[model samples]
Target: MKEYKPSFLFRNAHVNTCFPTFFRKVEIEYRRQRVLLRKDDFLDFDWVEKGNSKIIVLCHGLEGSSQSHYIKAFSRYFSERSWDVLALNYRSCSKEPNPSPFFYVAGKGDEIATALKLTSEYQEVVLIGFSLGANKVLDYLGKEEKIPKNVKMGVAVSPPCDLKESSLLFSKGWNRIYEQYFLKQLKRKVIEKEKKYPNILKEIGISIEKVQKATSLVEFDHLVTSQLAGCSDAYDYYEKNSSLFHLRKIHHPTLILTALDDPMMSEHCYPREEVKNNVWLHLETPQYGGHISYASFEKEYWLEKFVFETVNQFQNRK
Candidate 1:
């Protein structure tokens, strides 16, 4: 693993974390496809094809889509290198309201499995996920008894592997900003769902008013996510969905990237002990790189460059 040195321009965690949202601008042309799942739930995937045999699937974070800065940057980086890139958007995240009230959660591994099945045409497939999507990817890879032959490797960036601890940390000082930002978007989605499908809230036994009152991610999960996802409560959802406990089950080579000072994650999120015991798992903890942001003044973005370099090394080893 390469060492990640923070740039002098943005040494602070918050600055490196929040700088990409404003400073980074990347645009890539994609061919969109709507994948229909077994349960009839649909997910949208934005594909950038370079007529290559190797394909990379990119999963965005909570409330994020294919247009997210990190996804766009990574997609553009790999696409330029002639690797086919697919940015998979979770339900209701494509700026289009999904028919089902149940949205994507951290532990929804089946969705990722279905996505890989859909894109099984590629000879080589690499899974790359950020934040919540990272958790989902890790959970899926770990829990599955048999991984797809096309899946050569995986990379999870800034994943909250321990969901419960991370959720608690979100309500703490400075982290509340991210919690509020996510809650606002979640509440808006619920409201939109109610407007489009009037029976959705009724079916879930949750009201828009109750969802609006949720100021924290835990409250939102308890009231809305848990009920819709068939979990008894927020704790159950977190316990069942968190990837930390399942890391030992993973069979394929996987890289887990995280920062020590990520505002959205707690120290427990790193799972150092689990990674140490698991030969298949490689953990990279840089002192900097806030959340999904690893920006440097010298490059397009440090994270993207690092990811490309790491994946290239993995390919070379293979």
Candidate 2:
């Protein structure tokens, strides 16, 4: 793996993390397709189909949608390579509030299963996920026993493999800013759901009052995510869903690329020993690059270019 030498202007971790999110924009048109998951809920996929046999399924980060900068940028990049790209919008993350009162949690790996099942008809499939979605990618790859034969490999970017350790960052230092922003959006969603489905939410043990009281992500996960996932508390939710435990069991070749300087992650995100022992898993921890930020001076960000190269290498491998 090549060492990442970020431009001097974007050397700062925070700058690398926030630059594309706030400044960069990707232009592409998508054809929307909705897949029903049970009867009450569904996942919306934004696809850039080029009539190719190879397809890539993209899973976005926390609170991200098909509209996220990374998803849009990568969707465009892969589609240009003549690969069909499908960006998944987790349950409530889609534009329409999910009919079911439940929302997405960090460890929601089954969502990836539904995505894979939908695209199983393709000749080859590649999986790429960012942040929380990266964990989901690992979760599915590591836990699922019967993945489709058409599924080729996966790439996890800026994954918080250890949810418990990463959760602690929310209350400390500059990370609190990110926590507050996400918390505000999360609380607002709870309020919206409460208004829309008071009776159903009551039965499900969620309420706007609890959401408003939760000041941090851990608290929110404990109050909402754990309850929805049927876990005892935040720690249980983290233990059951963290991708760290799943890394060793992954059967297909997968790449795990995370930044050592990512403010949202800790050393646990990099499973050096596990990857060393597991032949199918590839781990890369760059000295630079933050959260989901890998800026470059080229036409695409460093991550986009690197993922393209990585996918090509895997596709051409004997």
Candidate 2 lDDT, 146-214, residue by residue in tens = 889999999999888999998897689999989998888888777777677666666777665777988
> Per-residue alpha-carbon lDDT of model 1 for 288-307, expressed as tens digits?
88899987765477788888
On the 0 to 100 scale, the lDDT of residue 2 in model 1 is 66
Question: What is the C-alpha local distance difference test score of candidate 1?
Answer: 0.87
Candidate 1 weakest ten by summed lDDT:
34-43
Off by over 4 Å in 2: none
Q: How close is candidate 1 to the true structure, as a TM-score?
A: 0.96
Give me the displacement of residue 277 in model 2, in angstroms: 1.0
